[model samples]
Target: MSATPAPNASQSDAFAQLLRGSLLPTAVVGLGCVVVGLFSSPKAAWSAAVGAVIVLFFFSLTLLVMKRTADLAPTTTMMVVMATYTVKVLVLGVAMFALRDVSWASGYAIGVSITVCAVVWLFFEMRAYKRLRIFAYDPDGAASLETPAPKHDAAPTDREPRDEP
Candidate 1:
């Protein structure tokens, strides 16, 4: 009944790996959006860059919190992630709303592009999480948790009594 030790991040491509791997893709996506923005509207490109920064900041914060509190309850973890996501979206939405009178089409495009990049990053992270499944426990008492029950070849207790004439 012994449990295997969790894999080390160093031994596997994990959270850090995903973040590192995403850098090039993120930059490529951002550059493409900027180029598109310049052609579509330079103002939109600038707005998209700002939106991307906000989104990345919020996403990184969520990851940091999750990494720190991996042992916490699932509800608590989801709440933190959801709360941060809501804040980020709200802030971005408010910014776009405030600039509604301006070239909103570009702004919206930029915002959506940044969001797409964030979603891409999230997909990689989720993949890594599925593979990692990191967990923490008291190493000392860990053995106790895995202790097996004593084995016995005892007969069934509920067996009916044999009748003798």
Candidate 2:
């Protein structure tokens, strides 16, 4: 099968910009969680860090999928997006369950950190999307509907007289 064409520079740049926008807020929240956890316990601190890492991991995975699918057909892209989200959610759930009773991890701290970081990332992403200037339809790029289709040598002439019953 032929590979999908690579995304244009602008499309790539938009994804990069989205990542950049989300990164700072998420990092700040993660750092704050770490600081708060530090005062609570070492386990808490570690859990907070793990939560941050998890959020970042999922975010990166999403970005990677989006980049790879950027040039694909819309239906294919949507399928990719849905599949990725489903996998990400399942993995996250499994990880959380497995780590729930771990001795060195504070469940409360991890939960809080994950929640905060996820929220921060989502808001940043939403804002970035809102600020993006890309248009769904570009008038300048559209072909004129009035343009005549090219005639092929083998095609039957439209002007040929036809007998009407």
Candidate 3:
């Protein structure tokens, strides 16, 4: 079977808008971590920066996958989402284990920065979704009440009445 088409421009635009909304909070969290880490050590600052980058990378990847799969069937979209999440989590776990013992890496700084930035990103993303008016569900099948119904008087019938015998 032929593959499904990609999402339209508007869907892509909405994803982009979400990314934009998340950016400022993510950056602020990253910068705050870096500044906090600075007082500890250069390595701590670097670790926080690495954590920020990792979070940003994963978040962007998730959004990219979501955008790419938006036009597909719901099941296909769900599969993609699960697959991406699985891979992202596995990779992050491996990276954390590998970097756990590195002398220059500050685990505490990385952990704290990642945690805070992730929470911030999630909050902003939720807010963006709440503010967006992309979809509305109407269970009753009533036409949207936003627009006024057209005015139409009953039309006269084009037939004459028969006389009774």
Candidate 4:
């Protein structure tokens, strides 16, 4: 069979962004925790990975919800993200606490990795937002419906009033 064609520049860029956004941070924290534990307490290192797996599972579920509900209001999306993060942190904390005698450095490593992932995700999101805003602001672009600004009062301003006062 013929060799497959290499991916285009944009595709490669997207893949790179995905790797930075999703994988690197998680791997960082996971590997860090495991290594730290390997020296201090091998058992805890293994246990921390299992715990991180559960947290990652929850993260995947949260991302799915966000993707499926993108058309929802900003407030709604914020609520979902916050709720998911809170739940994940609580569960992870409890699990780690349960293994109190274990080395705590593993937990630190896991936290660092997740933080790295979050930073990557935030960076990509900001980039996407910038692109969308730039496209929407293009002068030659097609006209589109504008969301009306909220009114502070119900007074009618359709016609000018007489200056009889």
1-165 in candidate 2: lDDT tens per residue? 997765487788889889988988899889999999999998999999999889888977798899889899999999999999888778767777777788889888888888788889989988987788777777686666567887786967779798999
- In TM-score terms, candidate 4 sits at 0.49
Off by over 4 Å in 3: 1-7, 139-165
**Candidate 1 vs candidate 4, TM-score winner:** 1
Q: Clashing pairs in model 1? A: none
Better of 1 and 3 by TM-score: 3
- Least lDDT summed over 10 consecutive residues: which range in candidate 1? 6-15
Question: For model 1, what is the error of residue 116's alpha carbon versus the real structure, in angstroms, after optimal superposition?
Answer: 2.2
Cα-based RMSD of candidate 3: 12.1
Query: What local lDDT does model 1 show for residue 50?
Result: 67
The weakest ten consecutive residues by lDDT in model 4 span 7-16
Clashes of each: 0, 0, 0, 1
Best-fitting candidate, scored by TM-score: 2
Better of 3 and 4 by lDDT: 3
Tell me each candidate's TM-score: 0.58, 0.77, 0.76, 0.49
Error of 2 at 132 (Å): 1.0
Per-residue lDDT tens digits of candidate 1, residues 26-84? 66776677777777677878766766666566666666665655557889878877887
Please give the lDDT score for candidate 1. 0.66
Candidate 4 C-alpha lDDT tens digits along 1-165: 897755444444443454345554565666665676577576656655665565556655655666544557889978887887788778656755655454544554454434444454446545644544434374864454566789989876888878996
